[model samples]
Target: MDMAKDLRGRKALTARPLRLAAATATAGLLLTLAACQDGGADRADDGQASIVAPGRPGEKSRTLTPEQAAKAKPDDSPNAADQSYVQRMIEHHRQALTMSALAPERAAADPVKRLAERISAAQKPEIGAMQKWLALHPAPTAGSGTTAPGHGHDHDHGSMPGMATEQQLKELADARGADFDRLFLKLMTAHHEGALTMAGEALAGGNNPAVEEMANEVVATQSAEIHRMRAMG
Candidate 1:
């Protein structure tokens, strides 16, 4: 009976690791297979970008025509899942930009100001990238930039996580000196954490290389920022 118990324990331990491995492998595969068809746009590529899906050893090559390729380009209304990821990240980074803009005026420590500067530098371009992707992308409607990445999200655009309401932003803008620094740190930290959550979700469910790469970068960079904000807080 003791020997039987040991065998069962070993099997359980082995099975646990296998399950985790399976999950990780499945996630990697999904990212590699990124493809989306809006229930509506029904359009293929708009005109420019093309995704050359990596070749498997034996499969015949598949290439999308310019029109079909254009269809794959990022759109404002990313699927409910992809939109959730994109929208929340955009809002999170917007707050960081606000915090960074305030640094010149209120941050007492050069380090805090420097961190804010870095945050602004990094996120501004990324914001443009994401926004441009959304613009080029075809959607069922205009101005519907709200892809969630993985989960079929249904949150109101106005109430996404990491987004500060108009009133909250106005309050932040009104702050001065150490008050600005304190609120900025606190808010940015929360914002960074929210981005991490969205990125993690994308890593688990997203397929597009562009989307996956962006999500991975968000996870690593924002994670570092969380530590930076904590130290500076």
Candidate 2:
């Protein structure tokens, strides 16, 4: 009887360790499964949709979820194209203003006079807005001279697409009545088309949101003006 009881006790001790080992393995497996589930949840939470994130200096760009990208600051910094377009466009508008200035006294047709008045009215405010924008966002002066290449104060009239020559302006200024109307419409049409070209370039190349908005407005307004001028002829 004593031998049987000792045998039974040893068997029970052995069974306990086996049960303990099984329990430990089961607990470890449960922990591992829980960690895997948590990792998947984290990935799901980060957002499923991926977006291209611009890289930092010396870093390669990486794909990110919209949620992750939203954490980053927005970049609407003006590019060189934006600056050039704004500066050149200001000069461009000034020429239009000069042309329109002659219309009230020189233009014979009522329609021509009214068109010139509208152009002047629209452009004057646009000039103010562009001037304000330039003031707000000044060009970098590093390594640049007193007058930057695309500075608002200074521009290359020859480089601009639609600018009238000295002789053309002289002709317009000297002419009166029907002659003035004809010349003005023709010159203004070419001028507006040139503006459209500039605006299109700005839209394609510029980075600044404000510049983009300005360029789009120019395109819309000038396109309408072009149609009107063509219709007048």
lDDT of 1: 0.61
Error of 2 at 139 (Å): 1.0
Return the lDDT, model 1, position 100. 77
TM-score of each: 0.58, 0.67
**Least accurate 10 contiguous residues by lDDT in model 2:** 1-10
Q: Assess the local accuracy of residue 19 in candidate 2 as a C-alpha lDDT between 0 and 100.
A: 37
Per-residue accuracy of model 1 over 73-146 as CA lDDT, tens digit each: 43322345454566556666776787679778777778778888889988998898777765664333434544
- The list of candidate 2 runs beyond 4 A from truth reads 1-71, 142-154
**Model 2: per-residue Cα lDDT over 1-233, one tens digit each:** 33223333543443434334544544444444455456632243545544444344486755555455445434557867788888888889999999999999999999999999999999999999999998998875656653335644456776799889999999999999999999999999999888887877776666677987787788778878887888997
Q: Pick the candidate with the highest lDDT.
A: 2
lDDT, residue 2, candidate 1: 31
* lDDT, model 1, position 101: 90
